[model samples]
Structures are given as C-alpha cells and as structure tokens.
Target: MVPTSSSTTDRVETFRLGPFVVPRIWTGLWQLSSNAWGSASVSKIRRGMARHVESGYTAFDMGTINFPSFDHQLIPRTAADHYGSAEIIFGQFKRSLPSPEQIVGATKWCVFKRTIPSRAVVLAAVQERMERMGTTTVDLLQFHWQDYSDQNYLSALRTLKDLKAEGLISAIGLCNFDAIRTDEICTSLGQGVIVSNQVQFSIIDTRPLHGMADVCEKHGVKLLTYGTLAGGFLADKWLDEPEPDLYSGNLTPSQRKYLDMILKAWGNWSLFQSLLHTLRAIGDRHSGLSIANIATRWVLDHPFVGAVIVGARLGVSEHPDDNQKAFGFTLSDRDNEEIEAVLSQSNGRTIITSIGDCGAEYR
Candidate 1:
C-alpha cells in the first residue's frame, strides 16, 4: 500500500480568474513524459496520478506534444476508467476527496513561432485528446508559443475564444506571453475568455518579476507557475555538487542549457551552496521540511500568483510529511533580504529571459 498524508484544511483555497475557480497548487504532468522520465507501464502512471490527486494536487497540466501515449496512457486511465488501474485509483480519489468538485483537468495548445494554428488545427488536437482521454471538453486550453515575430497568437487566441463560446472549453489561457503581449491580449479580447497566464516563475527564475507580475496584477489575471524547483536543480542533490555536467540526472537538453546559464549567473557551486544553506536553515524553522517546500512557499506568498505548479515524480518520491508546509509557512523581511542578497550575487546576467516563458523553449 502507498503511504499517505492528510490535507490540513477542509476548505481548499480558490482563486477567481473571472468566472473560473481553481486550486492554488497545481500538479504539472510533463514529468510523466516518456522522453523525460523513462517508461512506466500504464499501472505506474495511474499510481502516480493517484498519489498526486490523493495528496491535494487535483489540478493536472499536460499537453499534446508527446502524442499517442498521453491519450493512451494518462487520460483514459483516470477519468474514463478505460484501464483496470483506473478503477482502483479512482476509488482512492473518491475516498479521499472532500466533494465531487475537487478535481480539475487541464491541457495545452502548442504552436511555435510563425505557426498559425487555425480553429481546425486546434480542434483536431483537442479531438485526439477527447478520444484518448475519453473526455468531451478540456477544462483549460493553454496557448504555447515559440516565435515572437510570428505574432499569429492573436488569431489563435481569437479561435480559442470561439471554441470557448461554442461550449468546447471552460477557459482559454496563454503559456508564455510576455508582460506587454499579455496586456495587449486582454485589451484586444475585451470581454472574451482568458483566465490564467502559465509561465516559469520560481526562486531561481525571476523573469516574471521583471514586469510580468505587475502586468498580471493590473489585468486581474491569475498566474500558474512552473519550474519552482529549477527543473529539480535547486534540490538537495545539487547543494554541494558542481552544477552537474550536461549528462547529469536525466535532465533534458533544454533543461541543461537553461540551468547552465543559472549556474553561471548564480556565481557557481560555492554561491549556490550558500543559497541552499540559507534554505536549509529556513526549512529547519518549519519543522525540517525540504528546501523544496521553502522555495515553493516563497513564490506562493508573492502577489498575483494564484498557484505555483510543482512537478511530482510521484510513487518514486515525496515532499516532506507536512506537504502543507508550503502553505503553512511565510518568508520574513530578513528572509527576503537574504534570499535577494544571494540571488543578487548574480542577477540580470542570466540568459533565461531570452529563452522565453514557461513552455516557450519547447517551440
């Protein structure tokens, strides 16, 4: 049997993005990508999903890029009960769930630069998801981008707006829109459908603070952040280690390139060790929770953030016993000052801004 922890609160916090409400902490499913985390049979995937859903992370974010497997592997197994494993875990979720309103399902729309994804292209993608996952309407459809010059994003959002109007989706969102572009989109759409802006917002990646945070605050839009763990680089594994070689720890080429830039900006292993030391001390104050939880808490307490997305490798791993430590803790003024001092040890020198927000690198 899988060991489990109980949720500390009876009422789940909800953030309003216009007409929609969502849990503040979301579980990103990209780690389940076979290309990234090695193959797990259908049962392993279902077990992982059960762990997350049972552990208070009912919202899941996935995409259409990896193809056939996502539909065949994750979707049908859970919501549809197509897989035998689904029955077992669905029972688990029902047992632990407070009410039927607990679960939220989400996926993406990835069309990189210059690629004008029409209503047809977008619909086809959702159709495949529906057939494989055995669902009719995807709760949220995120527009993922690659090239800025392409600028066809306006039309794509317009098409997504139409889809929402037609009862095909609950909401429309953007994956990597910059501060300015996101403002322009809200202005153009006026009273259409857009609730969240999903992007890379973590302790290590402050690109959102550069102005995106203000933009979201002004627009009344919610932020769904990914990469809080710095692709697992900022974890205990790298505290004393020399920013792992390109071959280190099953990370993707894209992740390696991104982290390499941070190591350079962060003043190498020595400075990073100091940062970890700070986090370790802070964690101790919170009953010895993992530094990972401390890092996530700092972002959660920030303004305009509805939720911080944390990837759970699931079954294979776990956060501290008190996973609620993320919500239970707060960073003080001195904590912020010290964190800032460590981060300033290398700011503006980072290249992550050029790579783009949350999901832009994939494009």
Candidate 2:
C-alpha cells in the first residue's frame, strides 16, 4: 500500500533510494543548464537552493558535465560545455551547506555514441562526473544509453557496479530506459543493483502504465519521473487559456517541447483544457489545491513512483512552497475516476504504441 501520514514532517513523504532516504519531490536543476529557460547568477542560484533545502526539498537532480546533447538534439561540443553547469553550481551549493550530508545529488551520464564498454572507459566517465560535481562519491548516478542495438550497455553497467564496490558511487540508476531494457538490465545485473529509472510520466503522458509499471514492480525498482507537470502546462494558469504559438517568444524550450506533445501527440488544445477543468474541480474538493498539485499527486500516487523531479528555475522562478502541497493529501477514488474519464477521451494509449515506449521519442 502507498504510504501516507498526517504529521507535518511526514507531509512531503519519503522513500528509500538505495541506502539513502529522499523526499518524493526533488528539485530539478535542468533549467540551470540552459539560458533558453532563463538564467540566474551563481549567488542567486545558491540562495534559491538554500530556500529549497530549508523547505525540506533537499534532493536535487543535476546534469553531467560536457555530456552529450539531450532530447535527441545534436549540439556542438563547445556548446555542450555550457550545458552541465548545473552540476557545478549544485556541487558548490552543497559544499556551502553545514549539513551537506542531508542533500542528495543525483546526476546523469548519457552516452549518445557507441563505444566499447571497457572498465577504463566507464571509470573515466564516472571520474568526470565526480570531478564536475566536486564530490568523491555520487549519491546517485543515472546512466542513459542512447543506442539499444548495442548490448554493451550491460557491460557498462557491470563496470558501474564495480565502481560502486569501490565507494565511488552510492547507487546506480537508469535514465530514459524503456520497460524491456530496464527489465533486461535488472535481470542481467541481478536484483538490488538498479534502484530507479527516470522518465517522463504525467497525467497526459501515461505511457508508464502500459508495461513499465509492471517491470518496475517485478525488479523492485522505482521510477524517478520527470515532466509530471508537462512543463508547467498542467497548472492553473493554463486553464481556460488559448493554445500557445510555438514560435512565440513567450515559451521556453521545455514549454515548446511539451506543447508539441500535447497538441500533436497527446491531444489537441480543447481536450487538454478539459483535463485541466477536471483536475481543477478535483483540487477544489481537496481544499483548493492547485492543478499542478493534483497532477503531481496522480503520478506520486502510483506505488512504483519513487519521486517526481519538478524543474526549478532557481532565482528566476521557483514554487517550493506550492510544490510541497503535492504531498499531505491523497487523491480519492472519485478524483481518480474523474481523471480517467478525461484520459479515456484522449490518445494517450495510442501514443504509447506509436511512440514505442517511455523514451521512444528521443530514440
């Protein structure tokens, strides 16, 4: 059964991530890696980090240094250098904290190209991540292998397991891996080796329900989900609003990306508006919670979901207080039925097949 509590300290909820216990809502720093999402100075970003930690949102998800381009977009190596500063900033912020041990830093090492998965190669990758994060041991290192045709990802994982034995990594996880690959890796590596898989799971994008959920349950792995808010489109401000123009200067890169998924892949604007209305009504039933809280609660309600990685734009914008509301309340059966009623009208299930799986859009 899913855990719930009435205590104020237990409001946010906590889950076991390997040997560490982390809050279910992690502060995602993906926005700090790109100016397209808006930028903030280092001092300002650190201050924002302080505010989140004080609010009991101490877990952070950062990107790798000089990592390959994400979202299936190819970026020049020189430009890619600008992408992973979130790790550095997070590392600095952690060091500044008197209780740095309370902070959980989860970063990624995405391999977009095929390479031999020798121990040397894998160690180099881990070392680079360690150097960038300014920590000797990574709290959680999530690996992303772009090509599935190559089976060497298994070997790379074995190397990561060896590194874990050497005290370089506390835990190992996967990012954007589909159900089959996740199952195979966990099976090949044996149980207790893989802790989590990060993917896009939201009310509109319910692809995980198809098969990934079962795989996670079987392997004793949990999901660290992103895009649960659909780039803030699943919030109150978007209700009763007209469709946005992709080319308009108003939308951030993530907003543009999710907007396309909503219109072209998930459903049209009208259907999304219907979903917003349903969520709004449900939120009202639960003491006037925000639409984003209802949406996030839907994802966290799943027993297999370990946490939801909500993006924070640091000093530029943050909603730590509001995000905390996602916890403390569980959705009623009526609330779920109301959500499913609108979902049945959309093309989410079909999108699952068309898109292939959780991370198929990127592949």
Candidate 3:
C-alpha cells in the first residue's frame, strides 16, 4: 500500500512496504563491502548514520556479502550505539515514533551456488541476518539470484514469504531480477507477496523504464533503484574531466564498475559532461542544487520507482544537506525536455536494445 497523501516532510518521500511506510531515499551501505573506497574511522561511520537518520533518510539497504570482513561485519552496529536499538533508530525517522510499522531494515542473501538452497538453509540465513542487525525480524528481506535457470529463486522467495507469515520477516523483495523473471515470481506467488525489486536505474541507465517499469506498474510492484548516481560518477566532480584509466589507482571498485557501464552504455566522457552540464544548469535554476541532486530527483520522479539508493561513504563523506535540495524544486517540463534531449543523442538507446533488461548486466 503505497502512500497517496503528501509526506510529513518534503525532505523525504514515503511509500508503503507491507504494513509500514519507508523513506524514498535509502542509505546504501554496499561501499562498506570492501576497502576499495578509502577507510573511515568508526566514529565517522557512526556520526554519518546519525546524520542520515536526523535527515529523514531512514530506510537502509545493506547486505551480508557487502561486508566481507567477519570482525566488523555489520555496519548497523553504529546505529545500535546511536539509537539504542533498531526499533528506536528506525522509529525516530518515522512520522509516528516507536510505531512497529515505520522502520524498514532491508538486507539480502546472495545465492551464488550453482544449486538452490533448501528451506532450512534459507531460514538459517534469514535468522542470522536478524541476529546480526540486532532486530527480532527484518523489515524486508531482499534475495539476489545469479542464475535464473535455478528454479530455486522461487523456492527462496516462498521460504521468505513463509518467514513473513511466521513474523520473522515483515516483507519480501528481489534484487537484480529482470522483468520476465519478476513477472514469473508474481504469477507463481500470487499478489502481494513481493513488494519491490531493487535494480540499477539512473539518467544514464533507463533500462527499468523500458520493460521493468511496465511489469511493475501492471502488478503493484515498485522499484528500489541503486547505481542511480553511477557510483558517484553522476556527480559534478566528474563533469568535464579526463577519461579515467580503468586501472587508475584513485578509482574505487564501485567507481570502476559504474565507469565501465558509463562508457559502454552512456558513450564517452564528452557526452557525459554534456549531460552533467545540463543537470547543473537545471540545478542552478533551483537554488544551485547539484548535478547529483538533480540526477537523483530525476529518477525519483519516475512513476514506478519507490526509492533511490545513494551509497554513503560512512564517515568519509556526508551529503544530507545537498541531497535535500532534490525536493526543494521540481523539474519543469522544459527541464525534463532539456535532459531528455541530451539523452536522446547519447548511447542510451543502443545500451537499452543491447542490454536485455534491468539485471542483464549481472546475468
């Protein structure tokens, strides 16, 4: 049940997830998975989580695979220190404080094995996630599948749905599933079992708008978009810059991944600069926001999109104040036309035709 009325604060937008409403902007902690991004002090990560909470971006997206280190595996440990408990932390951002239905702690289990996991194996994984996050139940448990041929993805979701029925998981969602498979899941499970599909969607990557958007709209499903900033390449920092070498020491793993997507799907650096310049101009029209803010807002305006996942560099960087500018002003039809004009001329079309669907890149 997605919200129909205006949100309590313009800084955040709300959408329904099972019995709860979640913020439209989610804090992505995938960067914590590796040290490719510069390391930050624990204090910085803790303060950053607090700032994100205070700023009303409470819906969090984390994954077990994202944090490979065993010692400090879960970053939400910082939230525990700041807000005392997961309930309190998530409750503080919701309109109704301490309400059981406000917070959404979404985590995922990536099934990489050639064989499908059984019900018992899946349950153990979900329980482990709950224990790691310091919560009785996960607000949403997103599952990622690498092989579509393995009918086990369906079995996994069914197990998750059962967990939801048993009060272990509040909702179930998918990550990186394509339109055809998403349709299959919905048909197999019947309605209302799955709430969202987390995929890569951005001004550069409009693959969701092609097929996934229609499928989601037909059903009641919504999309939680990541790589929306192309791993921070969509920011103004890369505008008019030289094409970075693939092996550049300065590039983080995330940056390298998205940069390749940019080159392959978005064409060369000059074209990207043009797109960035257009976004910056649009931002200027509305209190000089930022290329990143304008880019994020563009995705949020898409009808089937529930939220945009922006990666937070824990303690190293903070952009709450700047990110809030997305809601300060709306993109006029003219602004949209201008942005589309640039996209129409780029390699976006070729990328769409070549790339099968939202998750084709991974497959």
Candidate 4:
C-alpha cells in the first residue's frame, strides 16, 4: 500500500519505508519479548502492542540476532495481526487485512552468523513467517553475520536480494556488521543491496563514528541506533543506587555488565552522579524531560540515523510521557556542554571493544 507520513511534534522526524513512513524514534519490543516470553501470552503481548502504538511507536526490531523472536513473537504476531481483526474478519470484505498504512513491521537477519541453514532452510523460515504473519511481505528484513571470515556472507545477501526481487520482502538491511564487513557486502552487491545498518550508537558508545557513519552516509545507508539510554542507567533511578550487580526487569546480563562498565568508566559512583545531576539540570530547563529522553533525543538528532530503538517494558513501567518529551524540545549547545562535561571525565569509544560492535551486545 502507498504510505503517508505520521504527524509529529517538530523535534521528531520520519523516514520513508518503501511506501510507508515511520517515526525515526520507535519502541523496540525485544526488552519484554526477550525472556519472560513463555509467560508472554497473546493477550498480554497484544496489550503491550496496544500501549506501544498508543504511545506513538510504529516500528519493531528483530532478526537472527535473537532467534527467539522469529519463532515465537515475530512470526506469530505477524500472522495474527496481519489479517484484519474480527471487526473485519467477520465479513467486512474491505477490511480483510491490516491497513498497510497503520504500523511498520520490521525484522533483521543474522546472515553472517551462518544460520541460513541452506537456501531451502532460509526459505522455509521466512515462508513460515509469511504463513504465521499472514502478510504478502515483510516490511524490512535485516541481515546479521557472525564471522566475516566466512565467504558465505555474500551468498546470503544474494539470497535476500533474490527474495526482494521476488517480491517476498520490501527492503533489506544489515545488523552488527562493522565498516570492513559492510564494505565487503556493499562492494559485492554494489547498488543493489542494503539500505540501513542497525548499530549500537549512544552517548557512551560512539564507535560507529570511528568510520562507519561516513561509509553509510556515502552509501545513503541509515543507522538505527540502540542503547541510546545505555539500558536505562541514564535514568534518574540510578542517581543514588549502588553499582548494580544484577539488574532485573527486562535488562539482560549483558545489559547489566554494559551499564556497570559505563558507571565505572564515568569514574565510580561520584562521576555517574555528576552526569545524572547535569542531565537533571538540563532536563529541568526543558520542563521535565528525563535524562533518558534527553540522551535518546541526542541520538535522534544525529544525521544519518533513521531511527532509535527505545526498549519497551509495559505494566512494570511506562515512559510514553518521557518518550514523547524527546520530540518536544531540542538540546542546546550549552546543554550539550553540560553533558559533555560529565562525559569528558570518562573513557569514550571503549564500549565498542568491550561489546565488539553495535549490535554485538547480543550473546
């Protein structure tokens, strides 16, 4: 279906998704769908979606980076919701399918990971997705590679390109790949491939600037940044807490370790508090925009970033108001100095080696 842009406050931006356009800032369902999923029944999951769309999030993130999503939520939820709801399924013929204009469904591929299984193996996986999602095609299918040493990466891209040509997918993307590896794929495909690079970009993790951004900019490749809030540590709740050993509620073990490193790099609890305090001061000037909304907006404001993946964990906590604040105001140069003043005391570009790459936070 032809797509139209959604209205947003001036601070927010939108990008074209084939015919569909989506907010550059979106709520990622992975945080909730990560583990507690067996308990994440359909009704409960739908409630999460209801709250998400209500909060103005119109996109999602998934791929081989986390296979649990492909089998459980991604494929199934797509199937259940792709068709029109009972209101139309009961016989309103014109409403037999979801309005293609309504939401943007996106997922990625860990193609470099060597999980393709086989040509048929990969085909069956997405076919199951089509059957389960009940849609003619996936909006975006991102590729992920585990090791660049494997020459099979290009083969995987070829398969994806073939599928897109076959009209089975709308757009293709790459996940967790560095400049070297992305160059390999792009050089192989030339102009016929990837449109976006999903990476880990935030205030703390700026490794993408090491050269990835320039490459993407040259290729017109979009970067969808994650960890903008550094897995919630940038929030006010951490302003007084002890360095957490094991964080609970939607954060994975890697997330806990990642944030702890940030706290350490910031120079112990003292420096962290300084950063939080500065964010609070800057945030106060903006009528209660939390540190998270500020940090996320900073990433959103960056050029070449088509979107930022903000984790969503409904019921336990809802940040629709704070999330909305991201699009309410802009960060000033002085405010950026206040933030950099705190960040200046810390080791920048260290998170990349620690985590390996942007999407390397997985595993």
Error of 4 at 125 (Å): 3.2
Regarding TM-score, does 1 or 2 come out ahead? 2
On TM-score, the stronger of 2 and 4 is 2
The best candidate by TM-score is 2
Estimate, for each residue in 88-168, the C-alpha lDDT of model 2 and write its tens digit: 888888887777888899988887777898999899988887888789998999998878999999999999999999999
Per-candidate TM-scores read 0.80, 0.93, 0.86, 0.80
> Which residue pairs in candidate 2 collide?
none
User: How would you encode candidate 4's per-residue C-alpha lDDT over 1-363 as one tens digit per residue?
Assistant: 212224423434578654557778776655443444223444555555555555556665542243321112222212111211211211221123256446666665443334545678667655655544566776777766665667677887787778888988888888778877777677788764688888777877777877788778777778887767876787888777775654465555336644655754435667777888888888888887788877887787777788888766544445755677777567899998888887778776564565454554442
Q: Write the per-residue lDDT of candidate 3 for residues 1-363, one digit (tens) a residue.
A: 123223424557678866767888888766555556766865566567767766777677773232211122222222111112322333233323344344466777666656457888888888777666667777887877877877888888888888889999888889889999999999899898889999888998888877798889877898999888887898989878888986688887677777776776677788888999999899888778889999999998887999888887777866876776776456799999999999998878666577667665555
TM-score of 3: 0.86
lDDT (Cα, 0-100) at 209 in candidate 4: 76
Per-residue lDDT tens digits for candidate 1, residues 1-363, read 233355433333557654456667776555555345444554566667666555656676762232121111222211221222222333344335446345666667665435558778767866655454455665677776656677788887887788778877778878777777888888888644668888877777677877777778777778888767766766667676765665477666335644664654335667778888888887777677677878888888887788877665545544523445677557888778878888887653353555454343444
In candidate 3, position 276 carries an lDDT of 90
Whose lDDT is greatest here?
Answer: 2
Poorest lDDT segment (10 consecutive residues) of candidate 1: 66-75
